[model samples]
Target: MAQISNISKQLQLKCSGERFYELFKNKMDSITQMFPKKLLSYKIVEGNGFAHGSVVHWKYELRGTLEAKQKLHMDDTNKAITLEFIEGDLFKDFEMVAVKGEVSDGGSNGISSVKWSVEFVKANEGVAPPHNYLQFALESTKGIEAYLCNNN
Candidate 1:
């Protein structure tokens, strides 16, 4: 068995924490429209919306249009969402990959922050953890934050 490692990144947003949480809980597919260059499309493969056990398929431009599937578990009261990677190139070197995002007030009124974290187990001792993938998550969050700020 491989060791499980975890990493997290925090970002401040101009948008409200409620708005940020709503995006993940209800409007995730809209992200493809907000960042077309990075995300192509997202479809609900099973279940409905952001409910637990819902599986989503994603097509995104990451080193040439990679595709992945994830199962979502959302906590509306806590403003948190978790995604477990089910299949994709990301799993090539990772035995399991899970990402979680939590939204909270960012020190002052009208400002918010999101903490994105990833936990993964490498496929083998020689396999390295996914740093670039985590960067992708951070950049995507920033892009969504900008989109929300500009649209609102």
Candidate 2:
């Protein structure tokens, strides 16, 4: 039996809530492009892009070639979007594994903080997933940070 584990990482970014959402919604492709090769291979497998119930196909090269379908299970009416994995490689199942781009704080100085996080669990015992999860996340943050920071 594979023991299930959860891993979550967060990042704080200086940007406004509304602008963050705008960048996230409008620039997802650009954001996706920033992801490492593993995440970049993942694609929405069902429904329309970014909507609830949408399924995304994710592939990681380091872990014996597995595909995980992430389903957008919830989008907060006010604050967040959550995706649950319905099927595919590495895990028996997973939920809200990759979370990013949410406003954590707002300020009067025309500045705000955005937090991004990713949480994932192994599906079974003995299956080592990719080692670059954090690296991938950080690179993504750096990419978005540079884009937003430079444009702002």
What TM-score quantifies how close candidate 2 is to the native fold?
Answer: 0.65
Model 1, C-alpha of 67: deviation from truth (Å)? 1.9
Index of the highest-lDDT prediction: 1
Q: Count the backbone clashes (under 3 Å) in each candidate.
A: 0, 5
Give the C-alpha lDDT of model 1.
0.84
**Model 1: per-residue lDDT, tens digit, 30-84?**
8667778887888888997756789989888877888899999898777888889
13 Cα displacement, candidate 2 (Å): 1.1
The weakest ten consecutive residues by lDDT in model 2 span 93-102
Please, what is the whole-model Cα lDDT of each candidate in the order they appear?
Answer: 0.84, 0.57
Q: Write the per-residue lDDT of candidate 2 for residues 1-152, one digit (tens) a residue.
A: 43445444555565555655565555555666665565547677688886667787877553456677767654444445555556765445442255434554455665556554555655444555433554555566666777777787
